[model samples]
Each structure stands twice: as C-alpha cells, then as structure tokens.
Target chain A: MTGLMRRWLAHAIFALAAFATPLLLSGNRYFAFIAGITFFSVLWATGMNLLYGYTGLMPLMFGGIAGISAYVTIGLSANGWSFWLAMLVGSVAASLVGIVLGLPALRLRGFYFTLCSLVIQTVITLAFVYFVNLTNGDVGISHIPLPELPGGRQLAGTAYELVLATIAVIGVVVLTVIVESSFGRRLTAIREDDGLAETLGINVTRQKLAAFFVASLFASVGGALYAPYVGFISPRSFDVLLSLNIWVMVAFGGRGTIWGPVIGAVILAPVPFVLQDYYTIKDVVYGLLIIGVVVLLPGGIVGGVKRKGRADAPAAVAKQAAPVR
Target chain B: MSDTTLIILLSTITTGLMLGLIFSLVAVGVTIIYGSIWMPNAANGQFFLLAALFAWSTSVSWGLQPALAALLVIGSSVPLSYALEILLVRRFYDVPNRNISYFVLTLGITQILSGIFSITYGVWSDQFQLPPLVPGVTMLGPFPIANNRLAAMLIAAVLLAILFALLRFHRYGRALRAVFQNRDAAALRGVNVRGIYRMSFVLGNAVIFAGGVLFACAYSFDLTIAWTMAITAFAIMIIGGPGSVLGALVIGIVFGLTQAVASIFASPTIAAFAYLGAMLIILLFRPSGLFAR
Candidate 1:
C-alpha cells in the first residue's frame, strides 16, 4: 500500500477504536473519565511533538501554557460565557503568550533556549500561584461547567468521551496535514541546520514563532478541555513534571512524525490511572518504562519502524537512527 | 535610609550572599560535569538528593557526628557518580543528540531515584543536622550572624577554593582542560579521555554531595528541594555561561541575592516569581558571559 493509504487505514482503525472505547468500558465511568483524559494527553503531546520532534525546540513550559488557558476558560465560564467561546479565548491567549515567549526566546540557540523554557515554566507557575485574585491562588478555580455538545446538550459520561475522542482524532488529522506540508519540510530543515535554512531564505525565526504559537494553541485547548472534563481545575494539575512527561511521550512515541506522540500518549497515559491501586509499582514502572524506551530505542517506535522501511536508504537511516546533538 | 529599611537591606544581602554561595557551590558542580562530559546532567538533582540523603542518614539516622557525615557523602557519591556514568551515560556518549539523550536518561534516573527514595525515606523526613555543629552567634564586625551560616559558608568557600586550585594546578586539571578544549585531540594525546570523563563526573558529583550535606545542615529542606536547587543551579550555570566555574559562582550568588531581596519586599512565593523573572531576563538577554561560548 502507498504511504497515504497506510495512514488512512491507520486513522480508520484509530477512529473506530476511539468511538468504540466508551462502549468497551461498558458503563465504567471511572475508566471512561480516564479515557477522556487520555484523549487530552494525546492532543497535548502531539502538539508538543510539532515543536520538539520536528522543529527542534524543546518546550518545558507547555504545561504552564495549558494551565493558563484552562484558568482563562474557567474564569470566563464562571462569569457565564459559552464554554466553546471561553475555550476559544483561552486558546488564543495561550498562542499570544507563545508568540511573546518565542519571539525573544527563539533568538537563543539550542539548550540555552531550553533553559529559558524551564524559566518560563517557573515564572508562569509562580504567576499562577502569586496572582490570587486572578488565578484564585493555590486554591484554584473550581466547578468548571461541562461543555455543550453543539446540539444544545451538556456532555457527560460516554458523551464526554465520544466528543473528546472525536476532537482528538480530528486534531491528529490536522497535525498529519501539517507535518506532510512544505512547512513541515522547512521545520525539519531548520532543525537540521538553522544557519543553512536561513541561508536558503527560509526565515527560520518567523517559522519558529508560528510553530510555537500553534503548539501553544493545541496545549491550551487541551487545558480548556481539561477543566470541564474533570469538573474542577487547579494549578497543581499543570506543573513542570507534566511538561516533562509530555516530552517523554513525544520522545517515546517518536519525534518528527504524526502518530508517535499519539501512540505514546495512548500507551502510557493510562498506566497511572489503571495502576491507581499500585502506587509503588506505578512510580517504579513509570520511571522504568521511560528509561527503557530511551536506552533501548533511541529513535523511538516511529523512527525504529521508519528505519526498517527505508532499508535501501543507508544515509537516511543513519541520520534518522540518532538525531545529532 | 530608615533603620528598618537599612536592616532589611543588610539582612537580605547577607542572606542572599550565603544562599548564593551555596547555590554557586551546586552550580559549579553542574559546570564541571558539563565541561568534562559535554552533556547536561538533569540527573544532577538526583545526586544532590542522594548526597543529602546519605548525609542525613549518616548523621541523623545512624547517629554519627555531622563532620563524619560530611566525609561520608563525598566518599559515597564519588563511586555513585562513576557507576552511573559507566552503566547509564557511557553508551550514549558518541551518538547524535547524545547530550539530549543523556539528559533524558538523567530525567529517567531522577524519577527512579525519586521513587526509591520516596519508598525508603517516605517523601519527607527530618534529616540530620550540621548547623547546630556551631550553635551560637558569630560576630562579623558589627553584624551578628548564625554560627551555622558562618561555618557552612567557610567550609563551602574552602572547598570551592580547593577545587579551583586543583583545576588550576593539578595534572588531572591539565588533562581536564585539554579534554575541554578538544576531546579528540586530548584523546590523541594519550590523555585517558575515558578516565577524565569518569573522574570529572565523580569529582563534580562529589563536591555537590559535600555541598548538599552542608546545605541540608545550613537550611531546612524537604525532599522536593532537590528539583528546585537543580533548576536554580541550571539558571546559575546558564547565566554564568555554561562551562565557566567562575560564572556559575557569580550567577548563583546573583540569583540567590535576587530571591532574597525580592522576598524582603513581597511574600516568598512572589519573591520566587521575581527571582524566576530575573533569571528569564538574564537567560534570554545576556546568555554569553565572561566565559560562555
């Protein structure tokens, strides 16, 4: 089969699974809730993959962006705005924050930019906690109302799962288009060599800003979705560890690809939920899986699989086998 | 200035300098590892925690003198660092994105170690004491200071001074400088590059281990403080210009001072916000230092 056909078939399988998941759980609201959260994880991690996997910019502050947007959406919803409208405002604000941070930050090179991202995480979380009147301090804004399901009904249980799963699937499709476009080529080129890409008149900095803006939009949207799904929102929910976990997911599933981060989130996001009864095992297994994936499969599942498919292309395989420092 | 304002300024500056010295001590540890290994060790925090744990265990749990616990951390952590380099870090040394890969590995290590420590030590514990080693007032001219702070600061300064001298004068120091200049060239010069990598990792960790002991004694900390210290140290190292020891010390002190001074005018959380903001400004605007490339 051609690459296009393979992708479509995969998406077909994914959509079917997503739609069937609520039914598969069979009235287990807890599992259903966990699945709903998983959908959001996939969304956020894939959004992160767009920047880190393809663009070579590692954002440790994506969680804070997500938190900020969630807070905005919640604060608006408390004042009685439509859930979708609140979400929209929240996402746009997140993207604006993205642009502000990226414009100054993208000027720095490599890990220096990464350190700045860490500071972003610190400063934003601090802002969340410090601005008590705005963010409700550490107590966090609560009772975020459920989103309307477009047909004038509030979503709950399987309805929530189905909506989130559908949206997540749609997000993956959009991301697929993005990664396969000319813009995607430019992203990879910049990742490989910023100087050479700039020499080719690609305007590397502007492209970076655009990518960061979109990435933040996706993350903040996930945050916007989160408040309603869980019916409460807190600053503690989005922290540095969450950002670190998203990076791990992207890396594990495979960077520079559409499905890797989704696959990563799908596989790993549910572990802790399922293992809720096993705290010790949960932490150990989580840490072990992370270490095992990096040490054992440096290219992640996507890169490993792609390397096999491109057996005839030695140089490409070598390059894909390990990203250069 | 009013007496209240003057006192606040003096106390904040004094506290900032002390905390900054401790931060500098930690950042210099990070700097040495980055310089020698060419990979940023995010797992450096784990070493800090381990050192603190060991120190705490030796003195508080085992009921040893604080001085012995201080020696114990240096002794234990050196081997631990060397072992980690061999088992976890060595394999990724030559790969593409080795630095990042190692960074991820260190993150993994942090989680694993955190898990183990949480299991063993139960999240937060009232660990050993080193400050009470000199429990009283120390007069520094007209300003009376905590004897704990004075003692810890003196030890930290001496240790840092010793490290500087080692790098400046020792044979290993020469070999390390050579490795930093060009890994391939130093290897070609029969400099035992692998040995340097192992030794630098150990030596870097050992100092932090000792510093961690001192820091734990000097300040009251919980388990999660390791993560904060690591980030603050990274901020220090980056502002100092990555591989520069002097830069690490200077920047670490600056950050500590920033945090201390900010706290005087606002609540600590707000002070933390201000400190992070200042670090962000410095990180973005003035990345290069007296010694950063």
Candidate 2:
C-alpha cells in the first residue's frame, strides 16, 4: 500500500540523516562526540520503547543491564579476547540477566512491577560496587582501548562515530521490522491486557520474556559500544538515573511510537553536554520537563498529536469510564 | 566471654536497636501513606533527606538546639505536606492506576530536590554531621554508645509507641483502618475518605521527617544517604507487606539487625546486597509480602 511505502520512505530519510550526522559533523570533534552520544541515547531510548511503550512494562533496571554488558565486554577484552567477540558475548549475557531480572513482571503489574524493577536496579548497582575486583569499586574503568580494525588501526574519532551511527540505524531498522511484525502485535495485545491476551491463546509469558531479551539486546549493544566510545565504565555510569533518562526520552517523545523516541533522543540527548557549564540546573530542568510532560502531555509529543486527531477513540473513552478498582 | 567479643556483641545490639527503631518509624510512615492512598512515594527518601538537611542547617548553622531543630522540622512537614497535597497529590486521588502516576510525579520531585541539593548543600560539603543533642557517651558493659544515639533511639521508640496507640485507639485511626480495609465500605459508613487520605499523607510524611532528623542526630550523613535509605525503607515495606504498620516494625528491626550484624563480617556494601537479595526473593515468592492481611 502507499502507506507502507510512505513508512519506508520516512525510514529511509531517517537512515540517511542518521548516517549523515557524524560525517557532516566530523570536522568538529566536539560536535561529532555529541552526535555519537546521541546515537547511543537513540539506541537506548528505542530499546526502552519496546518494553515501556509497546509492552507497558517499564524496566527501571535497563541501565543496569547495559552496565552488565559493558563490564563483561571490558573484562573479556582485557583478557585478550577480540573486542567484537567480547561484545557479542557480553550483549547475550546481559540480555540473559535482563530476562532473570524481568521474572517479577510475570507476577507484578504496572506500579508493582516498576517498584520491583527499581529494587532490582538498586541491587545490581550494589553488586557492582561490592565486587570491587570487577568494577574497580566505583573508581570505574577508564581509558578503554578502542576496537581494532582489520588494518590494525584503532577505530577512533569520526570512524567510531560512523560505526555508532550504523549500529543506531540498524537498531532502528530492527525495531521497525519488529514493530510491524506479528510479535509486535502480540506484545501490544499483552500490553493492553495480558490476562485477556492469555485467554485469547497468546503465550503471554513466552512473549514477555522474548520482548525482554530483544529489548535488553538493544540496551546491551549500546552499553558495549558506550564503554569504548567514552572510554569509561563506572557504576554511576549506568545507574537508575541512566535508566530513568532513557525512559524519559521514550515517554517524552511518545511511547508506543517508533519515530517518537528517536525524536526525543535527538532533542534531549545533547542537553547535558550543551549545559555542561550550568550543570547545577540541568537536573532541575530535566525534572521540570518530566513533570510538565506528565501533567500537560501524558501521551507525549507524538501520542498527543495522534490522540487529538482521534479524540473520540474508544480506548480513551474506556479509560475515562473505568472506575477505581 | 572475652572482652573483645563482649564489646562487639554489645555494639552490634546497640547499633541494631538504634537503626531498627528509626527504620521502623520510616517504614511505618511509608506503609501508612501507601495503605491509605495508593501513592508509593518515590520521593520518600528525598523527604527524609530534606528533614535531615533542614535539621543540620538549624542545629549546626543557625545555632538552634538539635532537639528544637528536630521539632521545627517535624512541625514544618505539616505545612509542606498540605502544600504538596493541594498542588499535586489530590489531583491523582481519583485517577485509576494513580500509583503509577504518583510514582512518576514523586520521581520528578526527587529529581528537582536532588538537583537543588547538589547546588546548595552539595557545594558546601560532601558529608554533613550534626552536633550531638546530648554530649556524653554511655557505657553498657564493654561497649560505649553515644548519649545522642541513645536519645534518638529512645525518641524513636516513644514515637513508634505513640503511632501504634493512635492507630489502635484514636478516632482518625479507626477511620483510616476502615478506609484501608474497604474504601467503598468506609465511604458507605460515613467515613470521610478524602479527609483520612489527607491526614494520613501529612502524618506519614511527618514520621519520615522525624526519622531523618533522628538519623542526622545519631550519625553523619551525605547526599547518597537519600537513595540508600530509600531502598532500605522500601525493602522493609515490601518485605513487611505494604500498608501493614506492624509488619514494618518487625521487619524493620530484622533488617537493621541484619545490616548491623552483617557489617561486622563483611563490608557495608555486602550487607546491602544481602538485604536486597532477600527482598528480591521475597518479591518472587510472595509478592504480597509476609504480613499482608
């Protein structure tokens, strides 16, 4: 259909822009670095969108999962393993851990699930600090070596940014593919009502775990790349705040929409870097934005627009009519 | 027993008791708020830290006695809670799945408060210590406990007793219990649900403030204490059963004891892990918590 063609056209445009950004900004290393970080944020926000947006389960331990991958990858690479192989192993390991952490989602729903995830995140952070031998006791691992290329040259600067752009673009394309697939529909059904979905023969548990694994892959891959890109890996680097920031991006852009989170990432990812000198008010500004988004625009920029177009949507009417249980 | 062993034993007991009582007070505060209203305040830790920070400012900077400062902070929570209730909380009271909204709202509050703290208090000192309320050390067998810590423990115990008594015998306490048991039934019985909700919110926040102030009086603190205490209090609440005051009291003591005892053998970080591990297990096995009625 023309709609599908239009969607792909939009995707192609986004892909072009994503790949072009690092190349265009390569002349300025500072801007290129920011662009690289934005790509990581985009990947993270997109991953979060799968769970938070489509599945309605906000995993606050998302950053912790990413940290798990970063640490594992660094640990393996230090042991003389190839960086690419280490990254693959690390991403898989982190996703497996994420599945375990998400076991509570099998039982708890909504607020309870969020609370459980918060606890899990706290525990993961503590584990990182407790295992000083592994995480360097919060001093963090710095000066991470860059991945070596086939010609023995280190992937650094603009080349590194380009690689990140490729990964981010691939991540978006993968998300788009998944979102348009039957699995995405099943996840959406579960999000709306897991019990109903289960009654309708949608293996809710299997589908939920599958979603966790897939989403966590996104988080882990970004985290693995993040370590060498920034040359840092600290417990603080992937704490609950990181998770919350990504979640905020997903929410602010509009959860449940593919491009919405990408837009959010583009707008918000550069904020901390842009306001580096005025760091004191950065959190305050972010906090105010969160409050503003929650109060004035619950549906987010994209969702609000969509809802406005379909003001009499049955879901909205049903939500309003539903009594407090 | 050997002298060192006796010293260790006595120290652990004292530390456990002090920590236990304060933990109970805060956990009870969190439970009451969650119970009466479905609001799981993510800002509970921030409120706790706020009181401690205020107490520090008053006692240390403004030259007020620590006890007087504690009183002032606890009293001030009433107005603060009222303002918060009016501005934000009451709006979500009628909203279904309000707990999620409250969690996000409080998280925003947490972010703003932490940002404010980083600029204001964070610029001054990484660690904050309040002058002891009573200047002396009390010797119990081989262990020496600070008089200030002992006083804080005593105050916490008395407050806990008072809270329990109010919940057991007071008219508002009965109304609160009624609402907690069944909101519709309570409303049908002419219990003012909204009034009880408002009162519980203020009362719960005040208790958390008391805990924070007492914590400052007993030991030095830092900004990181907010998150640590927040997780600890939440763990206690979840393990004890949300909205169950008695459960909070009992589990809070157990947690405090576990931390105190564990720290003797392992690092504090390990002690935190042990509790968190236990919390996750409890969540997995019994999501409703041990003391859910």
Candidate 3:
C-alpha cells in the first residue's frame, strides 16, 4: 500500500477508536479524556520530532510556546473572538516567537542551543505567571467558550471530542505533507551533518529556523486546543514536566518516523489514566518504562519492529524455521 | 534609607546567601558530573529533592541530630548515586546522540522518585525543625539574627571550604581533575577513567544530596519543591559555565541575591520571572555563559 493509504487507514482507525472509546467504556470518562488528549499530544510531540529528530535541534521551549498560544487564545476569546480565530492567532504568535528565538539559536550549537531554549522556556513561563493583568497568572482563565458550529450546535462532552478530533486530523494531514516535502528531507540531512549540508549548499540556518517555526506552530495549536478541552489553564499545566513529556513521546516512539509520536502518545498518554489510582507509582513506573525502552529498544518501538522485520528471513522458509531460529 | 528598609535589604541579602549556598551545592553536583564525565545530569535537582526527602525522613523518624542526618544522607546517597551511574549513565558515554535520552532518563528518575516520595510521605508539606542545630535568634547589638540563618551560613561555609580543600589536596580529587582536563591523556597516565567516572558521579550527587539536606534544614519542603527549584538551578548552571565549580558558586549566589532583593519590592512571582529574564539576557549576549572559559 502507498504511504497515503497507510496514513488514511491509520487515521480512520484512530478516529473510530476515539469515537468508540467514550461510548464503549462506561465510567471511563477519564480514559476518554486521555484518549482525546493523546491526539493533541501526538501533534505536539510530532512538532518536537520535526525539530529534534529531523533537525537535531533540541528545542525545550514546547511547553512555553504552547503556554503562549494557550494564553493568547484564551486571552483573545475573553475579548470576544471566536475560538478558532483565537487558536489561529495563538499559532501565529508561537511562530513569531519561534522566529525570534530561532534567530539567536542560529549561531549557537549543542549545549548552547539547549541553553537558549531553556532560557526561552523560563522567560515565557515567567511572563505567563507574572503577567497577571493579562494572563490572570496562577488563577488562570476559565470558562473558555466552546467553538460554535452551524445550526447553533453547541459542543460539550462527546461533541467537543468530535470537534477536536477533526482539527487533530487536519493537523496530522498537513504535517504529513510537510514531512514528505523537500523541506523534510533537508531537515533530515541537516540533522545528519549540518557542516556537510552547508558544504553541499543547504542553508542550514534557514532550515533550522524554518523547522523551529513549523514545530512551534503545531505546539501552539496543540496548547490552544488543550486549554478548552481541559476547561482550564494554569502555569502548572504547562510546566517543564510537560516539556519533558514531549521529549519522552518522541524518544519512546521512533523519533524520525512521521507516525511515531502519535503511536507513543496513544500508548503513553493513557497509562496515567489507567494507573490513576496509583498516582505515586505512576511517575516511577513511567520513568522506569522510558529508561527500559531506551536501553532495550534503542531505536524505539517502531524502530525496533522495523529492525526485526528486516532481519527476518523469507516468509515461507522462516515460518518453518522460526522455532529453530 | 529608613532602618526598616536597611534591615530588609541586609536580611534579604543574607537569605540570598543561604539560598545561594544551597543552590551552589546542587549546581556543583551537575557541574562535577559535567566536569568529570561531560554529562548534564539534569536530574541534579531531583537528587537534591531526594536527599531532602531522605533527610526529612531520617531526622523525623530516627530523631537524629541534623549534622548526623546530613552526613547520613550523604553517606547512603553516595553509593546509590554511583550505582545509578553504573547502571544507567555508563552506557551513554560512547553513544553519539543520547544526550536527550540522558535528560529524559534523569527526568524520568526524578519524577519517579518524586512520585514514590509523595506516596510514602503523604505529601504533607513539613518544615523540619532542628532546634539544636538552628536555634531561635541571636542579637548583634540592634541587629537581631535568626540562629537558623546563622547556622545555615556557618554550615555552608564549612562544607564549601572542605569541598575546595578536598578538590585541591586529595589523590582522588587530583585524578578527577586530570580526567576533566583530558580524559584520554589521564587514562593513558593510568587514571582508571572508568573508576574516576564512577567516583565523579557519586561525588556529584553527594553534593546535590548535601545541598538538599541544607535546603530542608533551612526552610520547608514538599514533594514539588525540588522540581520547582531545579529550573532556577538550571539557570544557574547555564549562567555559570558548566564544569566550573567557582562559576557555579558565584552565579548561584548572584541569582539568589537577585531573587531575594526582587521579592522585597516586587511580588514573589515577579522575582521568579526576574531570574528567567536575566537568564534570557545572558543567553542573548553570552551564550557560552558568564564565564565559559
């Protein structure tokens, strides 16, 4: 099957699973919420993968960028803008900030690049927390109006889930295109060797900045959508931990693979909900799992599977020889 | 200036010193690991938190003296930290693109430890009162000073002095330094690079563990405190060049002082932002840090 067909099948299955989740599982509202959240998180991590996995730039500013977008969307909506417009503005803001941040990062590399990202994360979070006049700080903005559909069809509960799923589908599709374009190949080449890429006529700086902007765009959109879905916003929600989670998603999934982060999100996002009652054990288990996966799988879940598949012999012969092997 | 304002400034500066000393202790751990093994060890903050948790449990449960408790925390933590070095960190030394994994691993360990602590300790935010170690208050004429602050300062000073002295005089310290300056050369000269790496990781975390004990003794602690404080320490480690012990100390103290001073005139939240703002400015101007060389 073609790549497009594979993606469509995956998207259809995902949507079916998402819709069927809340309906089939009684008293699993928490699980349903997480399932929906997984979709958004997948988008966020994929954004991270574009920069980190493809471009080899570790942008730890995902949470901060997301926070900026979330706050902007919520802040604008408070001034009477529609929800979708607010989200759009949030994405633009994140992109602009991405450009601003990317400018400085152009000269820096390795630890320095990481440090710059850290500084951005810190500054953005601080602005959100202390800019109380606008952001409402720790108290955070609430009662974010749900998007209005035709015929005055108001979104709540399952209805809101449907809406977010549609947006998430659009985001994944758009991102897929971006990932398959010449830009994506450039990013991967840049990651492999920036010096060599530059020698070969690639504009390394521009590519890095472009990757940063694109990643930030997705992160901001994810964050904005997250605000209304959760029905609240706080600095606490978008802390460094969330940033780390984005890293974890990319790492645990196959980093460069287009669908890796989404798969990771699907598996990992629901674990907390599944282990909700044992919250304390949850983090420890989560940490152990990440370490275990990295150490054992090396190339992550998809990477490991692909390796195994390649190593397998001819199917007809291998079937008979499997036990011996 | 008014006497009240003057006193406030003096006290805030003093508090900043105490906070800075604690931060320096933690930053040193990250720095030492980076210095000796060339790894960021982002979980430095988590180790500090763990040490605080352990310190609190030991002090409250065993009714041990604060000095003994600090020592006990350090003693037990050293082996555990070294074990972590062997089991997890050792594998990553040769791998090319595993720094993010290292970050993720440390962060994962941090969260897990935090979760375990919250569960076992029940997340009740408690201040460990070491009345004997940190008494009530002392008067320096008109300037009344809390004994707790005074004791923290004294302890920090003594510990820092000892650390510097050890780094200068000890065989292990010299070996570690040799490794830091050139790992291959040091290894060629029979430095036992692997052994040095193990020792550095332990010492690095020991400092962090000690810092945590000092932090717990100074004020209050909850499960989230270390994680909250780690970001500030990250700023310090970056502001100060990585692998520079003196840089860590100086930058941490400066950061602490700035935060304390900001807290007086501005809201506490604004003070936190000021640290981040300062970090951004530093990154813009000198990406290598205040003293990268």
Candidate 4:
C-alpha cells in the first residue's frame, strides 16, 4: 500500500472513533457537550501547532483572535443573525484582522515579533472593552442565539454534540491535508531559517501572515463553538489567561505533529471538569503540569513517547514518507 | 485648548513624568536581561510583583520599616532569581530555538507566580502604603502633586544615573558590557561570561524588585498587576530602545504622560491603548529598539 493510502486509512479510523465517542457514551447530552468542547479544544490546539510549531511564531496570540470572533458572533446574533451566518462572519473577520495585524508584525523578527504580538493581543482584547458601542464595553452582549438546523430547531444536547463533533472531524481532516500540503513544507523551511528561506526566494512575510490568518480562523472557530456552547459571550471570556491556556494546550500536547494538539486538548479540557470540587487547585495543577511538561518533555508527550523529543520527530516522519515531497 | 485644559495637561504631564520614572525602574531590569542574555524575560513583571510583596511582607508582617524591607528584598531577591535561573532556565541554553523556549519558560514561571500568589494570598488587591516615606503634596506652579511621587521620581533618577555610571565605569558593568557585546570575545578575554549571565539575571530581578516596591507604594496591587506592569514596562522599553537607560527614562515619562492625557479624553483602558498604539508604530521604524544599547 502507498504511504498516502495508509495515512488516510489511519485518519479514517481516528475520525470514526472520535465520532463514535458521543454514541459510545450512549448519546448522553452532558457527555456530548464535554466531548464537543474537547473537540473544539482540538481545533484550537491545531491552530497553535500551525502557527508556533510549524511556523515558529512566538508569543502566539490566541485570545485576541478568539475575542475578535466572539464579539463579532455576539454582535451579529444581537442583530438577529443566524448562528451559522454569525459564525462565518466572525471567523472571516478574525482572519482579516489576523492578516492585517500579521503583515507589519511579521516584519518584527525574533523577540520583537513576540513582544509586538503580545501588545497586539493586549490592545485587541482591550479594544473590545474600549469600543463600548460595539462590544457593549464589559457588560457584553448576552443571550446570544445558537445556530438552527434545517428543521428550524435550535442546536442542543446530542444533536449539537453530534453536529460539532462531525464538524470537528471535518476540521481535523482539512487540517491534516494542510499539514501534508506544499504550504506546510514551506512553513517548515521558514521555521528552520527565515533568512535562509528568504535567500531561497520564499516570500517569508506572506507565508507568516498566511499562517497567522489560518490560526486566527481556527481561534474564531473555537470562539464560535464556545459562545453557543456556553450561551454567553464576554470580554472576560477572552482574557490573557485564556490565551495562555490555549498556549499550554498546544505546548503540552506537542507541536509540529497532527495528533499532538488533539491529544493535548483531550487531556487538558477535562481537568477543570474532573476537578470541579477543587476549583482553586485547577490552575495550580495546570501550571505545574505545563512547566513539568515543557521542562522534561519539551517535544511534548507524543514527541517524548516517540523518542524524538523535538521537531526532529516531524523530520523523522518526513524521512519515512512526505506527502508534500 | 482652554486655560483649565492647559493646567490639566501640565498636571498630567508632571504625573506621567513621576510614573514614568517608576516604569523605567521596571523596564531597566527587563532591558538589562534582554541585552545581556538575548532572552526577553517575560517574568520580570512577576519578579517585581513578588519583590513588592516581599517588601510588604517584611514591612507589614514582620514589623520592619519599608526602607528596611527594601534592603531585605535586595538581599534575598538576588539569590532567589539566581536559583530559579540555575534550576529551571539553565536547561534551555543548548536547545534549538531557545528564544521561544525561554519565552514559554518565563510564561510558565509567570503562571507559577500567579498560582503561588493566589494560593498564598487569595488573589486579592489591597492598598499598599509604604508608610508615607514622603508625606503631603508639593505644588508645581499651581498644581498640587503628591510628594511621594516626587520622592519616587527622585529615587528613580538617582538609580538610573547610578546604573549608567556603573555600566560606563564600574569594572563589573564593563565586564557585563563586554559579555553582552560579544560573549565569545568576552570569554576569550577571561570575562567570566557565565558568571556575568548569573549576575545580570540576579540584577534584573533586583531592579524589578525595586520597581515593584516603588509601584506598590504608589498604587495598590493584585495578581494581575504583573501583567499590566510587564506590558507597560515592555512598551516603554521598546519605545526608549533596548539597553538605553536614558531612552527608558525619557520614554517612560512619555508613556505616563500619554496615558494621563488619554485618560482626559478616554477611559483608563483606552488611555493604555494610546501608548501601545504608539509603541506599535515606533516598532515599525525600530524593530531592534528605538535606540542602540
């Protein structure tokens, strides 16, 4: 069998298992909700992996991107828009914002890029609070409406879970394709040596901007799913902590690998839910775990398990069979 | 525009100048670490917060005066910063993309600091008055400004002057500069490159601690103070240019003044945006920093 066929077969099995999870939980609404949210986390982790793991953008700004979409989604819903339409508008807005911000921002190399992006995240999140007319200035647009199905019924419970899960699987498949595409190869080159890549005639700035745009789109996806899933949207929801939380998920799961982010989200998304009783301890445990993982398993668990412990793991995979090649 | 507005602007500028001095106190440490190590220490703000709290603990909990608390912080923070450097940060030196690794590592430390502060202190903000080391308000023409702010500004100016003098003339500072300029050359010249790294690390924490102590006296602090202070300090550092004390001094005041003026037209949060917005524009022109180290 060809490597491409074998990889597709493996992906097919993974998708089947993921889709079967809610069913395996006996169509339990609550379990479905948890599973759906975890899948959204998978979406987020994958986005971070694309930006930081593949392209090596530091101080990766997720909250600002997510906030941009959430606010848009809330604003659209408040204006009596449908959930699906609002989600698309919001995600597209986030992508545009990412491109605009990432254009000049990519000009900043190394530490400056990270610092400048951090400021952008702060300014974007704060802008939501500043523009009182637009974001309602901290009170936030409440009672955001969810998407309706073809039957004119609201999405909830098992159906909502199934819908999100199915979309997530599609998202996974799309991302897998992107990762193995020619663009992904260019990103790896850019990450390895921006100057070298430029010397080799690659448009480094546009590539980085594209990476940011895609990452922002995914963040918007997370926000879109999050807003309706929780039934509320607030500036506080997209605070700095949320950005850091997303980073932890990506870092802990492993970067530069397709499955790393999903595995990370699955492992971490359940922490607060499981330790609901010890609410105070959740952050402490999470922080310690992240530090431990970053220090001991820099390549993340997947990387550690595979004995690569770095992006070299991906390099090794490429040696075996690279689709882009 | 109006006479009242002019007065308000003057007062705001003065206030900003005072605040800027303290901000440079924070930025100086960050700049030194970055200049020396090529690693942007994101946890500098956390160090300041911790040091401020350490001073508060010593002064309030242990019944020592604030000045004494400041001295004690200097004595202890140096060691604490060194220990963290050796234990957690040293491991990243040989890693590929250590800059990114250090960024994340410092972020993790920031989280740990936040977590520890939450558990130990319950994530609360309280008015921190450092015993009114400088009491009453002083009149600048017609405006009444707090004497404490003037005191802080004075201390800031003195500290900055001392830093410049040390960097320019002191043997240790010269060694640090040599290391920062070219670590390989410095090592060849028997400059104790590794030792300088430790010294710079310790010194960064010490300055951040001092800045924290100063800020705590002027304002109240909560868990997120580090985030705000760190961000503001970073903006100031960038605006002033990296490793330039004079630049930090002038720009820190400029940021404060801008914030003050912004608050007149917009909210406090919006005012902050004004500084960050300017910093962003400036970064386009000077990606390395506004001034050379």
Please report the candidate that would top lDDT against the real structure. Answer: 2
Please, what are the lDDT tens digits per residue for candidate 3 over residues B107-165?
66777777677777774565444434566888754567888768877887788878777
lDDT by residue for model 2 over B9-108, one digit each (tens)?
9899889988999899999999999999988888889999999999999988999988899999999999999999998888888888888988888889
| Candidate 4's iRMSD | 2.0
Descending-lDDT candidate ranking: 2, 1, 4, 3
Better of 2 and 3 by lDDT: 2
Overall lDDT per candidate, in order of appearance: 0.80, 0.91, 0.76, 0.76
Going through the candidates in order, their DockQ values are: 0.53, 0.76, 0.55, 0.52
Badly placed stretches (over 4 Å) of model 3 are: A1-32, A157-159, A313-325, B1-6, B124-126, B134-136
TM-score of chain B of each: 0.89, 0.97, 0.90, 0.89
Best by DockQ: 2
Better of 2 and 4 by lDDT: 2
Greater-DockQ candidate between 1 and 2 = 2
- Docking quality class, candidate 3: medium
> Candidate 1 residues B1-293, lDDT tens each?
67666666677887888788888888898888888887777867777877877777778778888777788777988678767777887887677656666666777777888888788878466443443557788765456788877788888888888888898799999899899889999999899988898888888888778778778778766787777777777767766877788788777778778778777676777656655666677766776654674
Model 4: residues with Cα > 4 Å off, grouped in runs: A1-5, A26-30, A199-201, A308-325, B1-14, B94-96, B123-125, B134-147
Residues A47-95, candidate 2: write the lDDT tens digits: 9999999999989999999999999999999999999999999999999
For each candidate in turn, the TM-score is 0.91, 0.95, 0.89, 0.91
Tell me the docking grade of candidate 4. Answer: medium
Error of 2 at A259 (Å): 1.5
